[model samples]
Target: MDLEATKNLSASHTIGNYILKSKLGESSFSTVWKAENKITGGEVAAKQVYLSKLNKNLRNCLDCELNFLSSVNHPNIIRLLDVFEINLGMMFTEALLLDMVLRKSIWSSSASIMLEILKQTVIYMLSVSIIFHFCKSEYLQSQDECCVFLVLEFCSGGNLASYLQQHGRVQEKIAKRFTQQMGDGLKILQSHHIIHRDLKPENILLSGKESDVVLKIADFGLSRVLPDNHVETVCGSPFYMAPEVLQFQRYDCKVDMWSVGVILFELLNGYPPFRGRTNFQNIKSSSCLPFSQHILPGLHPDCVDICSRLLSANPVQRLSFDEFYHHKFLRIKGVGKYHGQ
Candidate 1:
C-alpha cells in the first residue's frame, strides 16, 4: 500500500480502549504493532492480518498458532493473549477486549523491568491454571472481512544470532544453560505434538537483558502439529536442515533436534555446523561438526558428546530433544544466564 493508503488503513483501526502506537514487525500477510490499552494504560504487541490473505493455508497457519499458543503455558513458549477480527464501517464498530496486561517492550520504554513483571504474571497465571480457549464471537463473510488481530506478550530482546554477534562465542557454562532451556522448551512441544520446523537462532529470542535473560522459541509460522509419527515436508533453513529434510525424505520432530545441535555448535564455535560458500554446497555436503575436545578446548567431554549426538547425520542416531535435558551437561546447573552476552 502507498504511504497515503497505509495512513488510511491506520486511521480506521482501533479497538476498545486500545490504540495502535507503533509498528513492531510485519510479514507479507500481516503487520504486528505495539499497541497501548488506554484504559489499562498497559502496552502489548498486536498482530494484524490482512483479511484478503486469509484463505486456505494462510488461514490455517493463523488458526494453528492460536490453538498451539493457547494450550501452551511454558515459559519458553510465546503467549497469545487474545485473537479477534475487526471489521465494517472502516471504524471501530466492534471491540474484543482482553484482560491480560503486558508490560512495555524494548522500543518505547523500560524493557528489563517490564520483563521481570511479565515473568511474575506468567507464574501467577500458570499456578492458578488460568487458560483461555480460542473462540470467535463472529466471523464476517469473505466479502465483509477487514482484518484479524492477535495480541501477544512482547519479546523485547533481540534474537540469539544478534546476541552471538555482539558477544562472540559464549563460554560453555552459559551455553549449556541456554541449551538446557531450549531442550526443555522442545520437550514441552513434544508433549504437545507440535514441531517448530524453524529452529534457527533467529527464531530463538532473548527475552531479557544481561544476566537475567530468558530464551523463548518464537515464530511458529512454519510449525506444525503432527499427531502421526512422521510428516513429509521439505521446509526449514538449509544450514540447520536435518539430512532427511535436505534429501526431501519423510521426517518428523527429530529434525528439530538437529537444528538444536547446529545452534549449540554456533554458540560454542561462533559458526554453524554446516557452512559453505554456496547454499547448494551447504545443503549437499555431509560434513559434520568435529566433536573433538581439542577443537572445542573449553567444552567438557559431556558437552561435546551431546553436540555430536544431536548433529548426527542419521536421524535415528540423533538424541531426541527430551534426551538432551537429561544429559549430564544440562544436569550441571550453570552459574546464571548470559553473564556477557
Candidate 2:
C-alpha cells in the first residue's frame, strides 16, 4: 500500500516515527493527541488538523500559529519542536526529521506554581539571549482526508479551568499568586506585540512534577500579533471580555488584562464578577456593575486595586502592562492573609 493509503488504513494510526496514543483535546479545526516518539520513549502532543475542515479563517489562524511558534522563543510559550507533512490518503510518503520536544506541562493554578512562574520569568529577563537560538518547526501534509500534525510540548498538570472546577476556587493569597504569574507571562507576550484575544483560565496550562507545577500559556488559535491599527474584532468569551470588545470598539492588549481581572475575581470570589441571565445582559453588566466598590470588601487592598484597575470600564483607564510588572500586590513576600478580610 502507498504511505497515504497505509495511513488511511486506520483511524488509530502512526505518522512518521510518532505513534498516536490517545486524544488530548479537539476544537473546531484541530484535535490534539498524546503521542509517543518510537525511538526516544518521550511523550509529545500532536495537534492534528485536517486540511478539509479548515476554512480560510482557520487556515489563516493555523498559519499565524505556525509563524509565531517558529519565530519566537520563550520558556513560557510551547516550543515547536518539529513540523513535517505526510500523505494520509495519497500513495507516496516521506519520513520525519528533527528531535527534542519540551517536556513539562503547565503548573496548577496555585501558589507554588505561580511563584515558580515569576521566578523563571525574572531569571529569563536577567539573562540575555545574545545569539539566535534555533528551534525546528515541522509540518505534516495529509489529503481531503489529509491532516497537518503540529507536534507540541506536553503539559501534564492540565489546564486551570479544570483545576478550579475540580478543586473549587482558591483563597485570596493563592489566587493572587497565580494571577501574578499570569501577569508576568502576559507582559512578556505583550512586549513581543502578541495579543491573546482569548485569555481564559482554560488556555493556561500547568506542567511539572508532583512536587512543583509551572504554568504556561497554550492554544494560540485566537492569538495574533499586534496590527498597525486598532483591533476591532468583537471576539473573546462574554463573561471575561472587556466592555470595549463587546462594543466592537478599537482595542489593544488591554483586553487580555481585562480577562485577567475577571479570572482573578473568579478565583478570589468563587464566581465571575459579571452575572446575567442572558449574554447581552452579561455584556451590559461589564459597564453597569460597580466592580470597584463591590469587590473591595474582602480582598487585600492591593488586590482590589489591581483588579479594579484591570476591570476598568474605560480601556484607556485600565491598568497598563508596566503596572503589573511592578505591582505591590505581587511583591508582597510570603502567603500573607487577606488583610481586607
Poorly placed runs, candidate 1 (over 4 Å): 1-17, 92-145, 277-279, 286-295, 333-341
Model 2: residues with Cα > 4 Å off, grouped in runs: 1-12, 91-143, 209-211, 275-277, 292-297, 334-336, 339-341
The TM-score of candidate 1 is 0.74
Local accuracy of candidate 1 as per-residue lDDT tens digits, 1-341: 22223323462246655678777667666777878777777777777777665666556666777788888888888777778865432232112111233314434376677676667766755543322113223353344445667787777786898999898888877788888879878887888788888899888887877798899887777787885667776777888888888777889888898899889988888878677666567655544534453246545767778888888778888897668778887886553333232
Model 2: lDDT of residue 136: 17
Q: Candidate 1 clashing pairs?
A: none
- In angstroms, give how far residue 286 of model 1 lies from its true place: 4.4
lDDT of 2 at 75: 57
Residue 306's lDDT within candidate 2 is 87
